[model samples]
Target: MFSDSEIPFDVIQAYLETHYHVHGRAPTTLQVGEANALLAALHETAGVACSAFLTACNPFSQQLEPPRNLELQEALAESLQQRGLRFIGGIGQHPANGWPGEESFLVLGLALDDAKALGTQLGQNAIVWSGADATPKLLLLR
Candidate 1:
């Protein structure tokens, strides 16, 4: 078993790519952001060191309209809350590139199992690479 800190960004990126390839579609910007946020939340909830990268973005982007985006955020929050996870929201410069843009994001701290369950519920794949020594695990949500 590997700790969250042991997971590398390259590993995560690889799985993310695999997710794209296997699904025959790349995750939307929103999905990428959400996945990162979820990973961060999971680490926080587990009291483990969170190495996940996070970014902020406009809550209302062109990809999603106002009410729908708001609804999605609310639904994700409610789901996490019901699962005993804490949601963290923030607005800041992009953590990865230090881009000069203020954005909003919601992250729910969850354990691996909880993350998998949530992904399943949302029709997403929770792909995680535990460590260099372990094989990547893909949890399909359909």
Candidate 2:
């Protein structure tokens, strides 16, 4: 599994190539991981479906105290410990706790149940995408 402290420049590419065994082309970002929305949802609920938490930060979006809190972290940690899901490379500067940005991506771990919960919580703020399971699509700040 990939460690949060040691993500390579071509980390995502390497994961795809190694796991999928089909390295057709490399991507600028990693799109083969879990979604940010789902991670947020699980954090909000504090449920058992919580997968690993892959911090995604950029120059734009930053972390807040309310929306994401210590309780959420505990829940995520507990849930992930139970599940077999592994935390991989993130989409921002800090792989552990990245800052947020507009269009910035956050790579999080989530099970199917967690994704469903996220869909319900998102309601209007987020969208349901089928192409990739959990890779966040991040954008840069000025």
Candidate 3:
């Protein structure tokens, strides 16, 4: 479906089918194009109209060692903290298995432009973003 990306079609398919889990007091699972009521409530509670699901692992779809991926994720978290952004740890995984779950963050109130910039900065091909609609969309950056 995401044929425009240089990323392989199968990889894009995996992204579309993967579950993006947000960890918090009330953990939530996000699926692309599916409206999440809990996330909607979260937006309301946080007084934020949008959020972005981002990861620094496997940059440009090049698989990295688990330790290195974790280190990159830590840096991403630190960067968000330094920006004074509210975020929750998360992971993106395909339910059918095979692909390793990627460590991610659900950054609250991050704008679309900022999300794209961050994804590009992290050498990511894409990011999952949602607005007040609470429906996650796969946004290609490359």
Query: Mind sharing the TM-score for model 1?
Result: 0.37
Model 2, span 22-86: residue lDDT tens: 11122233333434454444344443333322322110123446344344434544544566444
Clashes of each: 4, 13, 0
TM-score on alpha carbons, each prediction = 0.37, 0.28, 0.97
Give all candidates' CA lDDT scores: 0.36, 0.32, 0.93
Instruction: Give the lDDT of residue 110 in candidate 3.
Output: 97
Candidate closer to the true structure by lDDT (higher is better), 1 or 2: 1
Cα lDDT, model 3, residue 9: 82
Task: List where candidate 3 sits over 4 angstroms from the true fold.
Answer: none
Report each candidate's C-alpha RMSD, comma-separated, in the order given. Answer: 12.2, 14.1, 0.9
TM-score of 3: 0.97
Q: Where does candidate 1 have its weakest 10-residue lDDT segment?
A: 19-28
Report the error of model 3 at residue 130, Å.
0.1
Candidate achieving the largest TM-score: 3
